[model samples]
Target chain A: MSARFVPVPTPETGTYWEKAAEGELWLPRCDSCGRAVFYPRSFCPHCHGDDLTWFRASGRGVVESFIINHNPAPGYEQDAPYVIALIMLEEGVRLTTNLLGVEQTPDAVRIGLPVEVVFEQRDGIALPQFRVITGDGASG
Target chain B: MNRAAGSSPVIIAGAAESPQLGTVPGQSAMMLAVSSARLALRQTGLAWADVDGLASTLPVVDLASYVGIRPGWLDGTVVGGCSSMLHVRHAVAAIRSGAASVVVVAHGESGRSRVGMPPRAVDPASMAGQFEQPYGMSGTFSRFTLPVLAYLHTYGLSPDDLAEVPVAQSEWAAGNPRAYRDKPLDIHAVLSSRMIAWPFRVLECCPLTDGGGALVLMSARRAADLDLEHRPVTVLGSGESCEGPGASFMEDLTSFAGFREASARAFRESGLTQADIDHLMIYDAYAHVPLYGLEDLGFVGRGEAVPFLRSGATRPGGSLPMNTNGGGLLYTHTGMYGMFAIQEAVRQLRGDAFAAVPGVRTSFVQGIGGMFGAAGSLVLSNT
Candidate 1:
């Protein structure tokens, strides 16, 4: 079986994965349709256009949804009770990431709470995670 | 035009579940499939030679050769949990197109026995792994349970509020003799159960087991020709749809577009409204899935399912009785629970279900694949 902790990037998504290593959120944009494409795809899902470009993201979004995992997730056992969230970015894209700097309880983490990206770099890999912005930005 | 709204052309003439569900210690997955296939064939009183169409998540060649079937048409649409439901739709289309008759859709798994399944990563090197695994995430329970948080937060429901799902489903299971656990379930028991994932206790998840199920769908002519004691169940409407393979690609976490599209097309095809449905079965992979399934199918408005279920709407004696076979939660899951869903629907329509719903003239069955990657729904009526 393949290792679950490492990334398996293809030519299409190499740029996006490499940018994550540089502590930045970069995604592709279709030049033909002017629609943002996610998951580092080869073509625009909206227009099926092949002309795509990459750009850095604003790294700001709100929590659309999330779940707290109290069980072990292989390498993430120590991080039990972790918050996995679907963060909807301002650029109209949504991706899955962890919620940091917040209590693991449901009352602490909420939908529509404003969050910002935080990069975690180790073992030559950098991943973008989300943290609920404290103070005025925090809804709950 | 979809066939359901136009004409009802297919009839489910035969259906069977493995005689020994929960487990068959020595049997391989193939043995389970063949056993169920043989049982269904006997029910239809059709010989193996009469089977012209074959479908399953397993390779058709493996199951066919084992069962000695030389199918004229085959469908290998394995979309995780919804595979069998999708196969039924594919078979309906093929039967209508004059491609074949007497289509047998089967699903067999030894998830409990681990007889034929391959070993994979807690998280694999698929598209999901490439994007999310680098962060050290693993296992499906956590990844799949993430939607409940969204559901709770969106609807202002608490984790305890969601506890009603498994509790009520267990009540129905209590009446099912074949159910894995028929003991009464309560919100207190569910909330205090071991937390596999926060907000999702062990009871909220389906128990893995070993079993197989098969359904025989024949064209109207072939079905009419069948000389069987069991009443035929007509396929009044059927619909199947896929939303790719990635969970993060979902436009809405709390609701599924695939479920909505498939069920809408199914009801439209059936020419039946929500009030017309007498029974319902949705793949209960976890506690949150039913909530999503109910809302997406428009059985209830958004933010209505949790409260509706809490009000005993899906309880055994309640209006719109659901998952009467104890569902995947208390009943047998056997990896893909879709086949079991179909089997229960058939039994309920035949008025022979162990946890039978009274006078089930119309049943709507939905099967979900992956983590909302695909979904298929069917409207069945007693013939």
Candidate 2:
């Protein structure tokens, strides 16, 4: 049986998947409009420019908000309740990521809590998750 | 205190539910669309031949072929749940511009049966599939549940306010015979219900049901030419807009700007204000939706909806009566719940809804598609 579900990456988004597999977060930077694109787009969202550059991100952000799921997802029955969060990165963009190394509850998770990207490899595919850099259990 | 009450070019001649709601067996999604269209056409005293235009939330070519109406004009706008509401707006534009005379807007969703849209075998593939889905998250329950915490924390609200929404809507549902849920729901029932996600109980989510609804629209002049039994509900003004692609892109998680922009355009075009509306229908797929709608639509100030809701302003005999169809929470939510709101709006204007607000001259319906992805607002009136 497969350890996890890995999405078949499109030509446009395959770069993001490939970079994450190498333990690096590569975001698209628009040469024309200078806007940072997420989910690996083909064109610059700011100017619709096709000319874009890839750069490894600082991978630092804070929790804008989060929710703890008590229900089971399709591929993750053993991990019923987990924290899904919108992390506002230091580069002024937000992305959805899982908050790890903390209690998966509201009391444990607070808005503006600092987090850092930590990639976990499952079946040779790297999935990006967040861990607390500074919080109630910062040292933990 | 005078408002625009602007003249409208088009009016809804008739509308109908699929007549087969809840667990509709063996009926495919397209089948329900055809059935609902037929029901609505019957109400208008028109035949399939009179349908010169057809707008569908489903695949337009398939539904058109299935309904056997080769329309002069067809709109297949598939944004999300609010697609049907935009269809009404688009249909009006189509007719007023001499695109088509008689227009039929239909919605058919087999949310429970999963006829055409099969249940997830593999995980969904989208932006969310890449980011949120991998983290034991994905599905309507997980997507919508993310907003509650931000809303509550931003507004300094408690769990009790969230619990009160479904409970109050259930009271309205109890009065509606066609409402899907027969079991009584209360504050304790909602809060104590199984927590699907943090701060969202199972009762807070919309039930998966198989159903459809449709509307038959024509020029106001055409409505006056015929002796219609029901009051002709005019489409005075309509508004629609989309914000970011997803909630993650939204700057303010607490409020939806799309709802505000859409509702404002409708009101501004109609020359109306929040005070002028006698009734309202905000899509409540979950309890927090109404909270977002109320504040965003300018019915109440930001953070004022909780107190307003607690005051029962949205209940029966209130100043601003809303969601008399029991909403998606208790009433039939065939996935896209917008048309049900339109059905209730038309019924209220015709003076024949189960929980009708007294002297309802104007009804405003707000249709939400996706998680703040799109919105459609319509100002419907009998005047």
Candidate 3:
């Protein structure tokens, strides 16, 4: 089956997607205020600091919370019954991503479950995802 | 800001709402707004010509102009769901500054019945359309649902725990003659309802309504001198804050900073705390919105709202009478839930609500806009 998709990249967030392709989560850290920022911006919104740095993350976190998708959007019909979770990084940042490699039942994906980052190849690009870090040797 | 000598005190002189607003067919958006405006003017013993300031949400900009006097000051604030509360706050400022003597804030929409207004053609060169829309994060429901699910997971709360808010609010609605959903709902009924997106069943979501809500704010001097039998309610304090829009940029789904900031400012200005608020009219576009808002507003400790709700603190006649007018869950939600909060607060203060509570001298109303990205809080008092 052929899946049609497109990626729209902006100047501010282009580096983020590029780092994700290489199996890394890149966030802008304000040099002056030392805060990790998202929605990638050129300057720090908090302190208006121009000094910024891109750093790699450990890619390990727990599910802060999640919702199961029973009604998939039009283009995502095939991916019905998926789990969308807010994963809280150890560094105190949260991002939305799909939890793959498990049943999308509410009972199966409890809140605060341990999760580890993984990537999937979608339309020649690597998209970040997460899966439950089961102790039973099931690793994505 | 210094108040002008001749400025009005900005009291809620009148309020009116349309019946069964969202599901009606053949009713235009303009008609809904006009009917509510007329009802409010009649209730306040004022005429259309008496209104000098007109404010409305983006959905009904043109319609507001068509139904009222030519406003010397017009404010069309479209900050998503909290638009009405922000409008109320702005109206108070305008009145105190002597920019307008009388202001009317109104909203109405057939959001549930309408489908597919053609998408605006954004510049292909624009980064926003290219980056966000393609990821299926176009609508407010989809974006807000993501954080709600996360909040549920982290708290170890079941769907039933989240379901209790709507179930109890619907029960309150059952007693309200104007509530759209008058039937009582149990926890089981809420859990068994069709899932819109996993943990959020149909009952957890606010209905798409086509109703109109209007509130008339006049100067304290003018309200006191009016020959009308009903006394107006005073605007004690108001506060507003806006955060980044997208979910990715939010600090935490469970903790909305905007609400916290706005609520603190409102409470500080009003010289009241959670203990002082006898009534609460929280914005409830989704059941979870109020759950988070309660925590942000310092009514309960973080992650403790579920139990606070379970113990029935938010029910009618409880320690805190909350959403006594049925709220957005059972009352009509025309995209913006802010108007309903203002209406409920004014009614409670005036002792004119369908589900009026006794000894309600002070009331608090909170409105959430744009997936918890913005918040507007108000405190009203009979004293």
Off by over 4 Å in 1: A1-4, A132-140, B1-8, B122-125
lDDT of 2 by residue, B1-383 (tens): 02111233689988888888899878888888888888888877888998889998888988889877799899999887788889999988877777788899999999898887646533335665666556665567777667677788888898557877777777677856688975557788888888887777888888889989999999876666576768889888999998865667676788988899999999998898999999999998888898999999999999998899889888888888888778888898888889899999999999998877789999999999977789999999988
Better of 2 and 3 by DockQ: 2
- DockQ, candidate no. 1: 0.58
Can you tell me which runs of candidate 3 are displaced by over 4 Å?
A1-7, A18-25, A55-60, A90-92, A112-126, A131-140, B1-8, B59-61, B115-141, B149-156, B175-177
After TM-score superposition, the amount by which residue B123's alpha carbon in candidate 1 deviates from its true location, in angstroms, is 7.6
Candidates by TM-score, descending order? 1, 2, 3
Per-residue lDDT of candidate 3, residues B23-128 (tens digit): 7666665666667877887877888888888888744447555873578888988887788888888888888887877888887765665432224333322333
- Candidate 3, residue B332: how far the Cα is off, in Å: 1.7
Ranking by lDDT: 2, 1, 3
For candidate 2 chain A, which ten residues in a row score worst on lDDT?
A1-10
Chain A TM-score, each candidate: 0.89, 0.87, 0.84
Q: Which candidate is the best by DockQ?
A: 1
- How do the residues A39-132 of candidate 2 rate in per-residue lDDT, one tens digit apiece? 6788887688989898888888888877777876666676768788888888777888778777877788888888888898866678878897
